[model samples]
Target: MNPTASSGRSPWPYPGPRPGDDDPAGGGQTIADVGEFELIDLVTKGLTENDQVELGPGDDAAIVRTRDGRTLCSVDILIEGVHFRRDWSSAMDIGRKAVAVNVSDIEAMGARPIGIVMGFSAPGDLSLTWVRYFIQGVREECDRAGVSLIGGDITKARDITISVTILGDVGPEGPVLRSGARPGDLVALKGRVGWAAAGLAALSRGFRTPKAVVEAQQVPQPPYGAGLEAARAGATAMIDVSDGLLGDLGHIAQRSHVTIDVHRSALGMPEPIRAVGQATGIDPYVYLLTGGEDHALAATFPPGALPEGWTVIGTVGESSTPGSWAVTVDGRPWEGRQGYDHFH
Candidate 1:
């Protein structure tokens, strides 16, 4: 739910064929039209080779080079009906979101993405148009991050499922681990929070969701390189707000053995989100504190060292009570439900 506006165009070097490129009859093609291997070839047509990726798709495994001796890696899986719904999002939007969520982990670690490997599974009857557009969306977001979609596996499944693994280079400064936060460190945020949660609420209630808010839920645009920027500025600790703000910060606090107090007034909820709250009778603060899937960067830094897009919303402090919640708002513990847990 980062408030940042999307570029609104595919950033991929090769966007593949236009809609009319296939099936001059205008009905468009289905994945069933081409076998699995053929579909792979079509989707990977313009992936191209890059120097960082010594070996790319079509191989049993991909080879990537890291400038530093160390490499950072993160993986995530999005399952149909669980992570997203086809009716609510286009294939392209789902694809972009998959890439964004994985890439956000890399960025949160203060690393730059170098390569990605994906595993795609779907029913044989799925539309080829859907698959094609999905691949295009993935490629677009990867290209925007200057990362390569190196290689992956494809298969048949009861429903669409995308598994992605991203590799990143942390450079010499090393990754900004979540365990580094300290008392007096400033708590900062660099992307949206409540927008997606609010949008989801609107959709569930059958309310008229604003265009931007709906887009935020369907295709989150995480502040792509903000993690690296925070690292460069000497961030003490950091996390991607995939879960709700306080929930994720609780992670940082527990790991770093410190307390984090967020200032409610500093959140600056956008007008659209407020409108959504008004319509739903849901407090905007609930979205800000308990909503998830924003993928915004939240980190602790020296008070004056925060980077450009960052807004200081809190401060790290010492734990007064050992077993107490690690994160608070306006010096009090957040009273809302924590956040999403797949099995809970």
Candidate 2:
């Protein structure tokens, strides 16, 4: 809402609301409302720690152990009005998403995330209670992912921004990489795709569907154990569906120098996606091909049938062949929205 129209100023629904009501508290209190040390203290209370995090929260950096020889790490940032706005998400929602997306990278690498490092910045007047609630969401997700909070920092800034870096371990199995795929392999996924984008579209258009789709845009439902399952299933190249499936698959295709063909009909959420498309007047396939942040596990399986929950979305073909590195929905060529580009 426009600031002047509100009580002097208002909270951002800069993106709009879910349905019935909107509130101004999303902005929290000003910095003077809670002193920095007090604010920091509030956010750090009641966190769950792990054995690996011997020293956590409050030091210059948190310390963690890697019993294995190496650690896999991934980082992600959510910025106000950019990655998300208060109007579209709650503190708890953002916190859960901040953690889930970071862990999805670890999942993509065929590892289990063990720890997190967070950096948060917000206006000086932000509420200590709100920050604490955000951390509660993080803790809730960490419990699901079996991760612990090693450490993090808090500071006042012009806008609300949060970044999380996850540290994961794969034990003796090692991590999966982009270039390991080859020709003649079946491409597959473990979770739903395009739902997050569908939800985002709904929010953008002032529409409200099931809370399931709305929650998807706030925090995706990833295939929790599928990453490691794929690794054990002999998946060669693997990635999280952080970007649109087709676009992300393009990354693997380009990196592995293989052609990727997606069997669009096999996607898991065809019915729901089509329903969303019908409600919004968009092609449901567009959401599957270009929507992202579903955190589905996409991988290459050596010539064979797929595993349970895994669909053979496409096949890998020789890169040397004509029109190699191509990704299509159905037999026709598909060129649609690429995933999020930070520089844009």
1-344 in candidate 2: lDDT tens per residue?
01123234344342332212232345545555767787667667777787777777888887777777577778998898887766667767778889899989998988878899988888866655456557777878888888898877877788889989999888665577877788899898888788888888877876545446766898887888788888877889999988788889889988888888888667755565677788788988788878888888899989764568787888887865644576666655776566767676
lDDT of 1 by residue, 1-344 (tens): 23322345334222433222342232665666788889779767878655778888887888888886688889999999998887667767788889999999999998888888899998887777678778888988888878898888889899899999999889976599999998999999999998888878876665435756777888898999899999999999999999899889989999988999999999988888898888878888898887888799999998889889899999999887764437789988777687888888
Q: What's the CA RMSD for each of the models? A: 5.2, 4.9
Badly placed stretches (over 4 Å) of model 2 are 1-31, 321-324
Candidate 1 runs further than 4 Å off = 1-28, 321-325
Instruction: Find the candidate with the highest TM-score and give its number.
Output: 1
**RMSD score of candidate 2 (Å):** 4.9
Deviation of model 1 at 332, angstroms: 1.1
Candidate 1: clashing pairs of residues: 1-192, 2-192, 30-128, 31-128
Top candidate, metric lDDT? 1
**Candidate 2, residue 46: lDDT:** 79
